[model samples]
Target: MLLRIFHVSAASLFWYTAWYDQNFINVPFPNKEYAQYALKGRVTFLTFWCLVLQTIYFTLSVLNDYIGTNADQSKHASLLRTIKDTLFVLAFPVALYVTSAFWGIYAVDKDLIFPDWLAKLVPSWVNHTMHTFILLFIALELVITYRRYPSRAVGYSIVILFNLMYTIWFHCIYYQTGVWVYPIYSVLNWPARVGLQLASTSTALGFYVLGEKLNDFVWTKVHNKMVKSN
Candidate 1:
């Protein structure tokens, strides 16, 4: 019951944040250059996309908890479980990667990932909500739930497919706007850009592995407690 309440509350929070971020319109930049990217169609951003993903994951999770399972793990549960598992496999690693990559770059050079002018416009809370709180929320989900991770081949394939699709999407955005989705890409040459892409994909894959290991370790402790109680 407590976990169910947490899922409902988290779903509401992510939904609110994602909606506010999408509809937010405050022109912090003086000129059209930054305004075009900052206040306009934001789906081009991986961070925003991840926020949307988290929103959907939590919403689905609430539904799954309420009606997805019974004493027998019924057919309804099986279907919802598959969908939840697929979304979790994608959402967990990608969310972690985006948060890690965002803060890592911000720590070294805010301009590269988030510029000063942009920062002035977006609220500090919104900034942390999107980048920082996401990590905490997802990590909490992992600690509270035991998800059966897909096999390495299946998981890696899904991760690679997502990265590849986003790679194409951002490149298309660049072709259209004459600007990279991230400023870091603007400064890198082709070889360096390729290397960065590979490194990022690898980092996300590592997070997937870490999540699986953590899940197993956490549930093992939970199982022990139940056995001891019995």
Candidate 2:
């Protein structure tokens, strides 16, 4: 329960900071006053409500899984496979967005985004470099998935649709309120924005296919080693 609450809170906080304050591109340190403002505007209201729905969805899903009926070994295996497939599909674009945003923010000003408390404890470069590397590793992992799920046409289609919807919504809101959620998106002219969106979507889809392969390789190797030891 505590963990769930923490997750919900953290997710809400991040969304609020990103969507409401237009800090999505440059994640702010917790110490910044931008973190404390209450929600405002149509976009802000919509985002907050969507986050609430997401929290409910997560809660119900977890509860359902915890109390759901038992299954035979084969059924369990099939369910696990479905989950792996879904993750493999989703991980690609997620990794790309994460990495791209990391670089975008770092390029602007590395220290501004560091967590306030941690800022004093560690060097800014360390934080910046670590974040960059972690994002890159996630992208690499997404690439690795391709070896396992070589045919992810359905996944690619879903990702493209999702990105298109997101772009439309984001552009509409930005135009309506003259507020930009992400700095990278905000700076671009219409043509550039379109190009970036296309590039981002394509890269993400590619990464998703790659991620599935990497997951299979890692798990298979682990299983083989265990069997040999026994």
By TM-score, who's the top model here? 1
Candidate 1 lDDT over 44-163, as tens digits, reads 678877888888888888988888741222123477767876788888888899888889988998787678888887878778878987778788988877666678899999999989
Evaluate residue 23 in candidate 1 and report its C-alpha lDDT on the 0 to 100 scale: 81
> Cα-based RMSD of the predictions, in order?
3.8, 9.1
lDDT (tens digit, per residue) of candidate 2 on 1-230: 55345434433543443343343233333234333334423233223333333333333323433543212122233443445345435544554455565667657886544446546654554343333433443344333322234356777776777667667776665665566656556577989987887787777677665565555566576546545766
Q: Give the TM-score of candidate 1.
A: 0.85
Candidate 1 least-lDDT 10 residues: 69-78
Name the lDDT value of residue 151 in candidate 1: 88
lDDT of each: 0.78, 0.48
